[model samples]
Target: MAIEAQAPPPSATGPAVWLRKHFFATWYDTVFSLVFAVLIYLALKAFIGWAFVDAIWRVENKDLCTHDAGACWAVIESRGRLILFGLYPYEEQWRSTLACLAVIITIALSCLPSFWSIRRLPILWIAGFATFVLLMRGGFAGLELVTSEQWGGLSLTIFIFSAVFVIGMPLAVLFALARRSSLPVIAKSFGFFIDIVRSLPLLALLFAAAVVVPLLVPDWLQGNKLMRVVIAFAIFFAAYQAEIIRAGLQSISQGQEEAVAALGMPYWSLVIDILLPQAFRNTLPSTINQAVITFKETSIVTIIGFFEVMASGNAAIGSGEWGNQYVEVYVFLALIYFVFVFGLSRYGAWLETRMRLGHA
Candidate 1:
C-alpha cells in the first residue's frame, strides 16, 4: 500500500499565497481584487503628494502657498498659540500650559495599575484635580484670578473630559447595580431613571443644564454654568454606560453567582469580589468606547457658550488675517484630539492584556 501524504501547516503560507487563497481563488474575485488595489494605490498616492511633497511648513513662506496644491501647514505655525489657549491673556498663557500638562500627567498616572486601589486612586485624583482648579482658577498664593468664563481652548476641554469621566464612572456602576437589584420597586425605578436620561439628546440636556436649570433653581442651589454642564454630561454618560455594564452582568453565568453564594459569601462580597470585576473585564471595550464618545462630545459644549478646543480653533481662523486658513486650523485641532483619543485606546488595550494575565 502507498503511504498517505500529509498537508503542510497553515503557517507555511506566505502573504502572496494567503491573498491568492482569499481574493483570487475565482475569476470574479481576481477582477474585484485588482480594481480595489488600483483605486487604493491612486488615492494613497494623491494624498501623500498633496500632504507632504507640496505642503508648506514655514510661516515666512505662507504667502507663496497656492490653491493648486499642498496643505497650508504655515497657518498652524502662525496661529497655533491662539488655538491652544483661546482668549487667555497672553501673559497668563504659561499657567494654562502648566495646568494642561498637569491634567495630562494626572490622566496618565491614573491609568497605571499601581494607582487602581480605591484609596490611592481617590487621593491621586483629588490632588490632581485640586492642582488643576487652583492653577486655572487662581486666587490663592497671590496668583492672578482666572474665572471659568475665561477658561477656553485645550485647558477647558481637558477639564470637562476629566470631570465627566471621574464623576460618570462611579455613577454608572451604581446605576448598573441598582438596575439589577433583587427588589422589584428599586430595580424598576432605577431602570426608568436611566431610560429617561438616555432618551434625551445630549445637546438638549447640556442646554437645559447651562440655561434652563438656573432659571428654575434657587440662587443658592445653582452652581457655575460650567459645573452644571459637567453634571449634565456626567448623567448622560452614566445612562449609556449603565446599559453596557448591565449587559456585561447578564453575560455572566448564573452558576458563578450560585457558587459564590454556596461558599457563604455575602451579597456585597459576591457582587464586588466576583461579579463586578468580571463584568467590568467583559465590558472593558464598551467602557472605552463610551469614554471616546464622551471626549469628542466635549466639543459640543462650545455650542452652549463654553470655549473648548473646537471653539478655540474657530477663533484661530475667524481672525481677519487668517480667515482663509480654517482648514489648517482644523487639521491642527484634529491632531490634538487624536493624541488624547489614541492614548486612551492604547491604555484600554493595556488594561485588557493585564486582566487576561490575572493582574487586574
Candidate 2:
C-alpha cells in the first residue's frame, strides 16, 4: 500500500486560529496559558500603578514619600548626580560623562563586524581606553588632575569591565594554548595555575588585591588599588575564560588540524586563520554569556571600597534624608543594569543568528 503525503498543515494565519491552535491546543495547555496570561496582566497593572500613578517625582516631596503607598522617585531627582557620578568632583563630572560615552561608543563600534580584525580592535580599544583614562585622570591639556581613588559610579564600572575584557581575552587564548601544549611541564603547570585561580572566590581575590597586596609588594610594584583590582579581575576572568576556549578547541576534529599541518603551514597562520577562529565561533554563545556575567560582576567591586553603580545607588539612598527611598534607588540601579545586560543579550542573539545563517 503506497501512502500519499498530505499537504502541509495550514498556517495559523488568523488570530482566532492562532489562539485556538496554540493556547487551547489541549485542556492542560489552555488552563496553563490562561493562568499565565492573567498573572502577567495583574503584574503589569500593579507595577504601572505603583511606578507611575502614585509615584512622587518632586525633590521637595521627599517628606511625603514614606506616607505615600507608591514609589518615591524624588530620591532620584535629588541624588541623581551622586548615583551617576559618585564622588567625582561635581565640577569635573562632565569629563567622567564624556569618558563613559567614549567607552560606550568604542564598545558599540567594536561589536560591528567591520572592526572585527585583530589590528583594528586593538587600535580601537587603545584609543578608547586612552581617552577614558585621560578624561578621568586628566592632568593633561589643562584638565584638572583627579586621582583614581575618587573615581566612582557608572564611569568606574565601565572602565573596569572594558579593561578586564580587553586584557583578559588575549590572556584567555594564551592560557588555553598553554594548557594544551605538547610539553608535559608547560601543560601541567598552566593547568595547575588555572585550577588554583578558579578554585578561589572572586571576592577573596579582589580583597587580597586591594588590601593585602599593598602591604606585601614594594611601593613601586604595588601600583594603585584600582589597578591592582583590575589586574586581579583580569586574571580571574582569564582563568575561567581559558577553559571555555579550551572546550571550543576540543570541539574541533583531529582531521582539521592534521589537514592544515599536512601543508606545512606556519603555526601562527594555523592558529590565526584556522584554529582560533573556529574555536571562538564554536564557543560564541559561552563567550558572550561569560562577558555578560563579567559585566554584572563589576558590582562586586563595591565590597572592596570601589563605588560602581550599585554602590553609588546605595550612597544615593544612604543619607538620613532620603533613606526611606531605597526601593526607588534600587529600581533605578536595576534599570541601569538591565539596559546594559539586555543590550549584551540582544547582541549575542544577533551574533548567533548571523553565524547560524552563515552571514557572519
Candidate 3:
C-alpha cells in the first residue's frame, strides 16, 4: 500500500485507437485486416488505371480502344441517343426526353415527406402521368401521335414500371380487404383468385396478355399489347402485394378495430382512417422491396417484343461497330439501374427512420 499507483490504461478512442481496436484487436483480426487491405489496394489500383488512365472517352477515338486492355467508354459517348430513345423518331425524340423527365420528376416528388398525403400523392402522380402520355402520344396540340409500339428505351421502361405500381397498389388493397372480409363467400372467392394468379408464372401471364387476350376480348377492350401486358403485370404484382398487406392487417390488434367500432365509426372510415395507414406503415419495408423487384422485372417485357431500356442496350451492342464492346454497354446499363434501385433503397431507409422517430 505504500508503493506507487499504476497509470490508467490508455483510452481506446479516436481514429487510430479505434482502428487498432477494431481491425487489429487480436492476432487473427490483424492478419485478416492486412490480407484484405492488400487485396483492396490492388483492386482499386487496377480499376482506376483501367477505367481512367487508359480508358477511351472520346467518340472519335473509339477505334483506338478496340482490343485494348482498358475500358471503352467511347461506345457510350457515341450511342447514347440510341440507347436512350431507341426506335422513337429522331426529331420527336425531344418529346420522349420530356416524358422521361416528367416521370423522373414525379418519382422524385413522391419521395418527399410533404407529398406523402393520399390526396396530394394521387393528384401529383395523375398530372405527371398525364403530361407524360400526352407528350409521348402527342395527339393533342400540334404534336404528332406516336403509338405505344413506337415507345421504347428508358422512357418505356419507366412508364411500364410506374403504370404497374399505380394500378397494382389499389388492386392489392382491394384483394387484401376481400381476402380478410367477414363474408365467407367473398373471402373464399378472392383467396382462390389470388391463388390462381400467384400460382402461374409471370412470363405465362404476360404471354397470355400479349397474345391470347385479344382473341377473347372485344375490339375496343383489347386496347394495345402494352396496356394488356401492363394490366397483367399489375395483377401479378397485386397477388404478392395483397399477401403483404394482409399480413400487415393481421399484425394489427383486434382490440384496435373493436375500439374504433365501439366509437361508431363506419367500416370504410375505420379502415381508411386507422387500419390501412398503420398496416402500410408496418409493411413499408416489404412494400419497398416489392417495388424494387417490380421495377427490375419490367425488363421481362422485352421478351414480348417491347424494346425497353434493356433491349435498347442490347441493340446498342448488336451493331458491328460496337459489337465487341457489349461489356461497356452492359456496364452503362447497370449504372442506370443502380441509380434507380439505390435511390429506392435510400428512400426506404429514410422513410423507416422518419416513421421510427415519429413513433418515438
Candidate 4:
C-alpha cells in the first residue's frame, strides 16, 4: 500500500488550461469558439486592409480613390482644419486654436488628483474658462473680436459642455439639498420644479431659450441667444442630475447625520464635510454617465444653427470635392467623440477603483 502511493496526474495550466475550460471543454463549445474566431479574424482583416493597407492617405490624387476599394482618408487630410475650427475667420483661427487649447488644458488639469479639492477646482475652472472666453471673444487686449455666432466646430462643442457642467453641477447640489430640506413647502416646491423640467423635451427647452425668451424679456435683458441657450441647457441638466444626487443622499444612513449633528458640527460642515463627499462618491457612475450624455447632446444645438463639431463635420463633406467621402469624414468624427468619451469611461473606472480602496 505504501509503495502504491503516488502523486496526482499533472493538471493542464496557463493558456492551454484557459482555452480548454473556456473554448474547448465540449464539442459544441469548440465549434462555437472556432466560428467566432474565424468571424473576428475576417472582420479585423477587412478593417486593416480598408483603413491602412489600401487606403488613400495623401491629400493629392483624391480622384484615384474613387475607384479604389478602400477608405478615402485624403478628404480628412484636406478638410481637417475646416472640420475642427468651422467658419472662424481663417486669419484669426490661431486665437480659436489657443482658446481650445486653454480649455483642454483646464480639463486636463482638473483631472489631476491635486486639483480635486473644492477651492482649487473652482479657482482653476474660473481662471481657465475666463481665459477661454477672453481669447475667443477678444474685444480687448488688441486681439481681434470674434462673436459667439462665429464660434463653431470642436471649440464650440467643448465650451457648451463645460459651461453646462460648471453651471449645472452647483445648481444640482442646491436642488438636491432643497428637495431634501425639512421645510415641506421648500422641499415640495423644488421637487415639483425638478419634475416639471425633467418632463419637458430638451429640444423644446432649447428652442424656448433661443426664441420665445427673447420676446418675453425686456430688450436690455434679452442677452445673447447663445448665453440663453446655455442657461436653459444647464437648468435641464441640473433637473436630472439633482435626482441622481438625491438618490445618493438617501443612501446615506440616518445615524451618520445624527452622529455628525451630535458632535456639534455646523449644518454646513455636516453636509460639506460628511454627507456630500459620500453622496458624490456613491453616485460617481451616474454622474459620469450624465456628463457623457450631456456631451453628446450638445450636438443637438446644431438644430438651432449653432455649428458644433458634428455640424462642422457635416460641413466638411458638404462641398463638391468631398461629397463622396462622407464615410471617411464620419469615421474621423467618431474618433473625436471616442477620444473624449473613452477618456471619461477610463476616468470613471479609475475613480471606482480608487474609491473601493478607501473607506466604505
Stretches of model 2 off by over 4 angstroms after superposition = 2-12
Predicted candidate 2 versus true structure: per-residue lDDT over 17-58, tens digit per residue: 888888998999999999999999999998998899988889
TM-score of each: 0.90, 0.96, 0.95, 0.94
> Residue 66 in model 1: shift from native, Å?
3.4
Best by TM-score: 2
lDDT of 1 at 72: 82
* RMSD (Å) of each candidate, 1 decimal: 2.7, 1.7, 2.8, 2.8
Clash count, predicted structure 1? 0
Candidate 3, poorest ten consecutive residues by summed lDDT: 60-69
lDDT for 92 (candidate 4): 88
lDDT of each: 0.90, 0.93, 0.92, 0.92
**Positional deviation of 114 in candidate 2, in angstroms?**
0.9
Off by over 4 Å in 3: 1-10
* lDDT per residue as tens, model 3, 125-158: 9999999999999987889889989899999999
* Comparing 1 and 3 on lDDT, the stronger one: 3
lDDT digits (tens) for residues 249-285 of candidate 4: 9999999999987999999998898989899999999
Off by over 4 Å in 4: 1-12
Cα miss at 183, model 3 (Å)? 0.7
The lDDT-based order of candidates, best leading, equals 2, 3, 4, 1
Residue range 219-243, candidate 1, lDDT tens digits: 9999999999999999999999999
